[model samples]
Target: MNTWRQTSPTGRALLVTVLLTGLTTFMFLPLLAVHLSSEGVPAGRVGFLVGLLAFCSQGFSLLCGLVVDRFGTRAVLASGFGLRIAGYALLGAGTASATAVAGIAAIGIGGSLLGLAVKTRLVAEDGVPARDMLALRSTFVNIGVIAGPALGALVYPLGFGWILAACILSHLLLAIRLTLRPA
Candidate 1:
């Protein structure tokens, strides 16, 4: 129905942002385990690092909520994206165990704030039902879920540095565009 052309540019960007975020996230975040194991990191530490990512994404929501309330979605989204860009870079590039831990924490915290900011943007700005928006978002995520891993698999031999560079560049471009234009 030509809906793609009909939707506002900002709406399309929002959807596309989610899609890329999905792809970026799946591309290497999951590979932390493989990377750690190969590096001789103990299994227990690997589990803790992985688990820490999940815990921060959820555990820090209250703080994120407060941040959003104080700063507004645009600011929060920008900040979250900034954190994610740095976190992804650190996670992928850093060799030290301590650096990895810091990266994981950044990813988790950034993820929490990003999630909250996006949902809040959906509910507050789009007249569409949150359910519908969520469903659409999931569709993008599903595409990412399939493609992200495949892309990662293709790039694995080259190393995580390449993957992280792609991620950082993409996020940086998106952030600059979004911050300048807004939605």
Candidate 2:
């Protein structure tokens, strides 16, 4: 809290965006297996898809660091948010299996990029202690971790498409907020 107060507006915005992204992504996770199973996707395939999603996210984090170095934070963040929006939109539309895989992959990649952008941006800023910034970031992440599954469970009765739509809307709002703010 004190660290956040001492941080710049950019830092604050980045933290908020990270929080929202984490919330949306985690919220979708618990619902994913159930949703896919209900859609008639085999359990083994569902497990594989989930594994693919994690693999892409972890693998792309390293790549996104290079992209951030080359293209700058704004570009990387915009691209990431764009991908997330598109991915969620596809899921919301109930696309075919291949398309669903592509969408999940996109979500994974976008999440990696967004995460890298936030960390890089935070580290680059002057006067903010890296440890404090990271701690604060982790706090926001924990909040999402705690909130998402509970929220998802609470909203489970609403249907899977609604969950996807919520994610899409969250990403869309973040992208718009990023665009309107200075890089």
Best candidate per TM-score, number?
A: 2
Candidate 1 deviant stretches above 4 angstroms: 1-6
TM-score of every candidate: 0.89, 0.95
Give the backbone clash total of model 1: 0
lDDT of 2: 0.85
- Which residue pairs in model 1 clash with each other? none
- Decoy 2 TM-score against native: 0.95
When summed lDDT is taken over every stretch of 10 residues in candidate 2, the lowest stretch is: 87-96
Cα distance off (Å), candidate 2, residue 157: 0.7
Q: Write the per-residue lDDT of candidate 2 for residues 88-167, one digit (tens) a residue.
A: 87777774788889888888898898899889888776787999999999999999998988888877789887778889
Each model's lDDT comes to: 0.79, 0.85
Model 1 lowest lDDT segment of ten:
1-10
Tell me the deviation in Å of residue 118 in model 1: 1.5
